[model samples]
Target chain A: MSKHLLTIIDYGMGNLHSVAKALEHVAPNFQVEITADKARIAAADHVILPGVGAIRDCMAEIRAQGVDTLVRDVLASGTPFLGICVGMQALMHSSDENGGVAGLNTFPGRVHCFPKDALDVHDLPMKVPHMGWNNVYQQAEHPLWQGIESGERFYFVHSYYVEPQPAYTIGTCHYGPEFAAMVGRDNLFATQFHPEKSHTAGLQLLKNFTDWNGRL
Target chain B: MPLAKRIIPCLDVDRGRVVKGVNFLNIRDAGDPVEVAKRYNEQGADEITMLDITATHEGRGTMIETVRAIAGQVFIPLTVGGGIRTVADIRAMLNAGADKIGINSAAISNPAFVREASERFGAQCIVVAIDAKRVDDHWEIFTHGGRKATGINAVEWAIRMQAYGAGELLLTSMDRDGAKSGFDLALTRAISDAVSIPVIASGGVGTLEHLAEGVNLGHADAVLAASIFHFGEFTIADAKRHMASRNIEMRR
Candidate 1:
């Protein structure tokens, strides 16, 4: 089997260590390197954008490292790309966090915070940052969902969620209201939940991504 | 389905090894932190909380190593608490691959530290650990592993912590710690209802039924216990089964 180089784009944000370790655990044949170098990322066999913290800081650092355009270029080139947490949110057109910030606009959507007065189905006031294991319902079939059931639970820890166009949304989860959980088209797959921290079901998703050949 | 109430297995680490004590006294060896954490992960634990019970500053290094070792293999949320006092401390733990940094005494000494840490590292990763002890009519915050009292009302402090940007609250009842008598339901409910952020009810979980009560009665977003899980009295699956039987949503 040919070796694959999986470059985890590190713009000085997010949990790169855990993500790299997870990828290494699942795909022994793939070489995982965490780097902010544009050349290394652009030349890799696969790319992952892992992010956390605020969108403003994420976008600022991403742009500072010149990864914003590199990510767009890489995704457009049909290179398999994955985004997690804020990395996924940064792909949207804008976010309603930190007084509103612009994103890469890779997908036509906006990221919005859970309503201040949001309430769970139990009529109890819902908490922000929806931090826990929640069911991720597959809205559309995709290669990443292979070997993973539709209603499998994944760990989620974020307050703002993406509102992507119907054409780009592949999965949905509910906290206060139904929101996009996984979004992608062709070779690009991004998730608001962290697959690296998610247990068995999450490892399966990463394995599927590693095995994917960037085909629909 | 809504978000399932989480079942977290906490491992109190003292100088690189896992230890447990009743009511925060008589500390006894449990096992390796990494091995214990991995075991819990395999048993379908929703999350793991590693409390660095090591009091010395040098012991912090070992805790970091433990966190790194666990994060490399265990694929679940890991929270590292105990003696996290500075922004540098928070950064070090997070860099060591901890998903969240649990701050206790620091939040009491310097309230602004919570704001500063949250602003620097985002609220999602900043967990304010409030140790509370019941005092007559109300609960008061305690520090130094339930040794020192801060004279701060637990409910009021929780509200303040939320205002200062705590993404989550790990509310532990000091009086109930390791008592195996179930949680302080009144204390848990008071803080859970006071804050909009998720609250993980910690301390005093002896049986599977107690875990369910933490959610059903305490109204906690998550339930945490150390001895019950570490001593092998109950597996995480058993807790989930009990919770599910009680009609509480669980990951399953």
Candidate 2:
């Protein structure tokens, strides 16, 4: 069996070292590298795109580094891929953050700031940025959640959400109303929550993604 | 749904590794903060607190390099405390990848620093750390590495700090610290009741049930401990399992 190579694409928005360090800690034997190189990304067995901060700055860095073409090529190869936070938003067609920005268009959807009306009265008094832990609702069953239980909470720190097609959403969380939290189609999977910060459940999710056979 | 209570593992970092003891004595090597942090991250710690116990007493700067090193590896929200006195220190730590900065002796000495920090960096970025010890049958605030008594009531101090713009209160019981009997429920409940902001109960957590009891009876928003977690006495997974079995709302 050949060893899996995991490459975390760094576009210089937020911290990439933390994501790389987490991957190394979890799967020490696997090859983990934080790279912006296009060829290395294209040649990896699995691709991970992790981002933080505003969508405008995130996309700007992606364009400046020419990571868009590299990421598109990796997905075209049909290898497994995972996107985290703004990385997941970048998979959609566009985002309403920073006066609306175009995304990679890997999936059919748009990311927008969560509507105020969808929030419950208890949460209405809460502040923006929605920083903390929230419960996630499983929209559909997928191999990535094989061992995880339903209604499991994940650490979230974002005001924007991805409005993807219902068919593509694997799980939803209610910060305001039912919003897409995790999305999967074929070998590609993305999450709006920070799985690395979600503790045991989050680690289990990452383990599931690493062990997935890409059958579904 | 009610806001879920948090289970936090605190790492007292000294010279790069984690250490723990009662009254801050007989320090034993815990483990690499990075490695232990990763384990807690995997075991379901709601948050991780890295307290640089030596930074302030030794008159050193905040451990930005150590924080950056840990931040590079752990994906959980990281809170770094000790030796943080100025807004620049907070900014440096946050820029180094800390999600929040904890202020202890500094805030107690100069109350206005809290308001200034919160004003410049937002309230959510500041965490006020209070160490309380019983004196004359009344809980009083202790400062300067738990050596000096401030003659301030714990509850009153908590309320005052919140009014000064502290987003969260990390209250520690100096009397019960590292005792492992359990959290000082009296102190926990008092501070939790006094403050509208989140209160993280610290000191004397031994068993899994202690955590649940702290939240249910003490009304603590989170529980922080060191000896139990540092000495391999209990893992976060085991703690959460016990909490869940008792029907305590925890992030599984």
Candidate 3:
């Protein structure tokens, strides 16, 4: 078995260790490394960009380490890449969090915070962050979801959800309004949920990413 | 499908060991917390909360190690509580692989710590744990493992905690703790309705029906139990199936 290098893009603002540990648990053959180094991230076989905290701080850290340019460069290579939470949000042009923060503009869209009047299916007013578990409905078939079932529940903890361009939405979920949960375009994939915290289905997604050959 | 109600198995840990007791007394060993947390993870528990019973200054390092061990073994969200008194403490636990941090005594004392931690770490990672006891037609908050009465009204405190930027509340009923009588539905519903954030009803979960009631009647977004799950009365899977049978939104 060939060992794959899975580098988790650590911008000093993401859930670095847990994602690294989760990746190690699921894909044993994949050598996981947490780094902000541009060269190592570029040379890795698979890349996972994970984030937490505010998008403003995350963006500042990413830009400080030039991980944003690295991500754009990696995307251009058609290499297998996955982004989680704010990492996914950073792919957008801008976010409403922290009173309007600019993003990488890798994907043409904007991030909107969940509406205050947003209620769950129960009609009860949902919390701002939309913390805990929620269902992600698959919008289209993708290789990353090979063994995963549609509408599988994944853990989430974010106030703002991405409103990506219609064509790139691969999965969607609801809280106040229906928003994209998982997005994909060729060798790139991202999710609004934390797959590392998402248990079985999450582990499966990580495995699929490791096995993926950056093909459609 | 909507967001399913969570079923969390709380491991009251002390110096890396899991313990079970009534109102924080007469503690008995359950097993290694890491092993227990791993079991719950494999058993389909939505989350695992580790309340460092020895949330003392000296035991902090041991608890951090325990959190690290559990996070390394279990692949689910873990909430570490007990003596988490500062933003530094939250950092240590998060660094140790906890998805969320649980604060009770310290939050009640400083109050601003909740806001500080929430502002620094983001509210989604902060959980305010409230131990309330029904006192004269009202639920009053208790501190120090429910030993000292703080005279803080549970309902009102729940609201303030929310205003202070708590993402979630783990409300436990001191009266029903380890009683197997079921959750304090009145308190759970009152707090769950009082705040927009999710409320996790903990303590006194005995039967599978009680688990269902935590959501259907108590309006809790999650149900946390100890004795029922610790003593091998019912596994997390059994509880989930029971809740599903009761028509509650469950992950399985």
Candidate 4:
């Protein structure tokens, strides 16, 4: 059997190693490489876009390396693609983080700051950058959530969320009100939560990604 | 959802190799930081804290090369501490691929350094590490690699650190350190109560129960240990299972 190749796109924001480590843990036989090379990215069986930091900086680095073209090409090839945290937000049309910077636009949507007013009313006493565990309500059937129960907890650490069209939204999580927490369309999947940081359930999610045949 | 308690494994790196000791002495060579970090990552460590135990006395900066080396192998939130005295040092560590930079002796020397680092970097990037010893029936902050006493109460100092913009406190009980008995519950609770940011209890965690006690009784957000983990006395998987059975919120 040929080994599966997993390429984790590194754009120099934060903690790219953790994502690669998680993939290796879930799929030990799979080759995990954190690369910025466009050729390697194009040839991978699975691609992971992992990011941390301001949207502007992330987009700038992606553009600088011409990864925007590479990533789009990989998606067009119809291989499994997963974006995590800021990486997920980077798949949108734009983000409000840095005066509306352009994103990969693989999915038609805009990322915006999580509303502070809603948090205040919930008396959750949660600060911005909602840095902890939260329950995710599965809104639709998706392979990524395979073997994972609905309302299962996932680790989250961000203040912005991708507000994609309802057709692409697969799950919603309530910080103040229900917002898109997971999105999927054909071979593309993204989550605002840090599944690598989420623990066993998270590892299982990654396993599902690597083992999935794109049958939802 | 309630905040889940984090299970963190601490690596005390000396000259690139990870080492472990009981009570902070009688150290034993563990393994390569990269190898050990990969082991812990496979076993499901919520986060990893790397401290360059010899960086200060070496008269050099934090171990960037070692950090970068391990960063490629281990894919978990790696928090690097020891010899972080300046913002430039913090930047260098971050660039070397550290998720968070922990400042102990430096933050105590200049309290404003906490605010400065927190302001320049995000608050989440700044972790204030407090090494404390029980002296005169009080937990007093210790410095200079836990060889000198700051004469300040640990709880009082923790509150002050939060005020100065420290996002979290890595509180280590010097008296319990390397003892392998358990954490100082009274001391851990005192610091946890005094600060709003997460408190990571370090020192004297020997068993899975010790980790649970530190979280449930000590009110620690996370528990860090070296000897028990480094010596293979207990794996992180067993620890998490034990904690989960005891009704402690952990990533299982």
Instruction: Give residue B37's error in model 2 in angstroms.
Output: 5.5
DockQ for each numbered candidate: 0.79, 0.16, 0.62, 0.18
Candidate achieving higher DockQ, 2 or 4:
4
Where does candidate 4 stray beyond 4 Å? A1-12, A20-49, A54-81, A89-137, A146-155, A159-167, A172-180, A186-188, A196-216, B1-3, B31-35, B56-73, B86-97, B110-121, B134-140, B151-167
Q: Which candidate is the best by lDDT?
A: 1
Each model's TM-score, in the order given?
0.97, 0.68, 0.95, 0.72
Q: What is the interface RMSD of candidate 2, in Å?
A: 4.7
Docking quality of model 1: it rates as medium
Q: On residues A178-198, what C-alpha lDDT tens digit does candidate 4 reach at each position? A: 668899888889898888766
As a TM-score, model 1 comes out at 0.97
Q: Following a full C-alpha superposition, what root-mean-square deviation does model 4 have from the true structure?
A: 5.3
lDDT of each: 0.91, 0.79, 0.87, 0.80
What is the descending TM-score order? 1, 3, 4, 2
Q: What share of the true interface contacts does candidate 4 keep?
A: 0.13
DockQ of candidate 3 against the true complex: 0.62
In candidate 4, position B86 carries an lDDT of 90
> For model 4, what is the C-alpha lDDT against the true structure?
0.80
lDDT by residue (B1-252, candidate 4, tens digit) is 444577889999888888877656778999988889889989978789999988754524437877777765665568999888898888888767687889998887788899988766656667899999998778999886578877898889988988877767899999888887899999998887666567899988878899999987887778898777787888999898998897876665
Interface RMSD of 3: 1.6
Tell how far residue A200 is off in model 4, in angstroms.
Answer: 6.4
Tens digit per residue, CA lDDT, model 3, A1-216: 768788998777745888988888988888999987788888899998988878988888888888878998999888799999988999998999889999988788789988887676456787666877888888888998989988889998888899857899989998768888988887898999988888989889988888998888
